[model samples]
Target chain A: MSKALLQNEVIILDELDRQIIQATQSGLPLVPRPYHHVAEDLGVTVKEVIRRMKAMKDTGIIRRIAAVPNHYALGYKGNGMTVWDVPSELVNDLGHKVGVLDFVSHCYHRPRFLPDWPYNLFAMVHAHNRKEALLLVDTIAELLGKHDRGHDVLFSKQILKKTGMRLL
Target chain B: MDDLDRKIINLLQEGFPLTEEPYADVAKQLGIDESGLLSRLKSLLDEKILSRFGPMYDAAKLGGDFSLVAIKVPKDRFDEVAGIVNSYEEVAHNYHRDHDFNMWYVLATESPEKIHEVNADIEKRIGLKVFNMPKLDEYYIGLKLTA
Candidate 1:
């Protein structure tokens, strides 16, 4: 594990925390008092459920308790997995700038298999169509400027399987 | 979707307020009644526009490990190899892409060490090298799609 992740492992969740996560991992029921339902199911008070969820969010365990929109269903037909060949020394700064763009959803610095795969920076961009997605890619290219050595957009052909965020 | 539905989606994608009356707060902001907001959200979910409506947890932070693995599956054996790879419950998403390393999947396990074990099992069964690419650094991971 990386030093950063190892350090984060220190914050362990208790049994109650695990129970809460297990109960709500799929999703929170869309009721007037969703937490109340979860609390009752887990044999806890509504206040306790909210407190634990808030704590989890504060600790970065929960990014956000929000609605995850389906880009494709929302008329975003063109989805591009754009990869860039960026210099290792400048990836951190360049990645930050690329990530801040509204169109780019996910940005990460991954290892490259030299000779075979030269791209190290991955950013996913979504748009109404292929043209729009490429335009977004061009915008990213403009942002990278001198740091971007090369880039390519790999549009997914099909989804063989998509079971969103399942962990038991 | 109508303008009102789009507006609700745009707002909710950012986040839902954490309070006793969270729906009321969001409804007030959107200029709609609390019941209307709830029913709209329900309909969006029912229509399959929103995959889910709840807290988005960080798997890694919750003591789970996630890795992106790619494989070069020959056209003839692609289906067979995919079955072998997808059989494992740890595989969350398997996507067919247009590239030499055409098959890509995300694997989630309880621990970091299990990532290697699962990869080994996959490679052994498929008779192909699995390029396990775990994110060295995550710059950002939020996708907000405005309708």
Candidate 2:
């Protein structure tokens, strides 16, 4: 896993990799030496665990190893999915600019349905309240400028279900 | 969250070190003892301030396809439709948003083609169009909320 070539290339997950992910999927234990705990449990070594994690990160398989704060608990009670109907020709350049905004969290260029749906750009925004979220949407609106044909913010009313991915 | 907890959240979001003793490394950087740092993290989790703390995997890179699907479910049948949608293992999360296209959910499938199959299946069963909006380009995909 420490090999530079392996780090730079995308590698498929072997049995060992899958086992390690399953073991730590929920989370690494809250201990002083977390990797050592995982290694000991898996009968490998601390170095192996760290190396594999590094490889995963480098290859973009693992986005990051960090804390995911609860936005609601952290005072970001308002959450809205701001969708834009930008011309397909200018979406690539416009998407890049919208994605870099401090308030936009997850930005992507998605497809639009015909007749009724026309938005192709989606950006999830968060703020302390709906007002603030709308204001953030305003900032994005200003950024989009003339390129933005139309837009709407869909505020989340209820979370029907919330769970992380489960490897099947 | 108090001052120290705020500091911990802010710093941890930036990233945790990947050293021999990562927690100890973080503790030293935060001017706290290893045990104290561990205890604080445990409390944060117990209190649900931090929903999760671990590696965030990219499903697409892991040989899976993810999509944001929306349905314009009728208001009278929303609950029934939600139940039907949530019953599938492919559905990662479902949310009810205030809009004409109200029901939105994320689908994670073993293969890219499975996404369309699942969408068609759901459409046939629920009698509504499943708008499959797979990401064409991902510009950014991280959220860092300052505590």
Candidate 3:
């Protein structure tokens, strides 16, 4: 009956850290020495910039410095938010199982609003088309087996906005 | 995308090196020159193949709060409600989906209290109940999509 949310140790960001975030939140400068460019812009040394970034990364403030591909552009057009109304007792375990699937991008145990919404387990499935996405959902359903009370897939009709989290 | 582009995407997704000459270091590993690697990355981003190329920050870890919220908008009033919801700076990644709870978006704020405040404000403005479904448990995240 543990409904504890996964909490990471929050890190207090300093002024320079905030500045770094602002500078790089949109993107890192596409240059040979991108960190050095940021340092120059912020009136700090390259070493200082790298040190602060490393610290932030180590503390989990920055998940990772990497490239995020556009799924649609990559031909993953069938994006389905598959939600399941699984037994509360088995949600966490089932979520882990679904999450490890190659096609499942995100899996989480969320609060269920009964009467209207019964889904507590949410998994995002990506595929090349609707048929493929549904097939992937079947894979999750098979994996869940008897625990899969019921589920529904919500395909995105339109992307109104997708700016991600911008620290303002 | 060619072999080199695929290679860059796969390798970069793993992580970009944090160093004085990070791109150079990566280039050496890819057996390409520093300038060549940079150009390929630039082209990938410009061509919209790569949505983003930077540090993905964990807002919660950085002392911020975020939640997934949905509002069942009337079909006729969808655009109006969407405009109102999207007007808020806190609202990120809004989508129209195929369901009764059609309008779903994520609210990321600098404080946990702000999450509630924003949700309440949106409900009041739109005259619809905003269903806030925050994660009680994150079983897993970060699926590396192969190029």
Candidate number of the best TM-score? 1
**In model 2, where do residues sit more than 4 Å from their true spots?**
A1-10
Best by lDDT: 3
TM-scores for all candidates: the values are 0.96, 0.95, 0.93
**Candidate 3 wrong stretches, greater than 4 Å:** A1-10
True contacts kept of each: 0.75, 0.81, 0.84
Which DockQ values do the candidates obtain, in the order shown?
Answer: 0.75, 0.63, 0.67
Which is the winner by TM-score between candidate 1 and candidate 2?
A: 1
Model 1 lDDT tens row, A97-148: 9998999899999889878789999999999999999999999999989888
Task: Report the candidate with higher DockQ, 2 versus 3.
Answer: 3
Tell me the tens digit of each residue's lDDT in model 2 across B1-147. 798899999899878776778888988888999999899999999999999898887777776778899999999999999999999889999999999999999998887889899899999999998899888887887777889
Give Cα distance to truth, residue A92, candidate 2, Å.
2.0
Candidate 2 per-residue lDDT over residues A78-166, each given as its tens digit: 89999999999888899999998877889998899987899999999999999999999999999989988899999999999888887
Ranking by TM-score: 1, 2, 3
Q: TM-score of B chain for each model?
A: 0.98, 0.96, 0.94
lDDT of each: 0.88, 0.87, 0.89
Prediction RMSDs, each to the true structure: 1.4, 3.4, 2.4
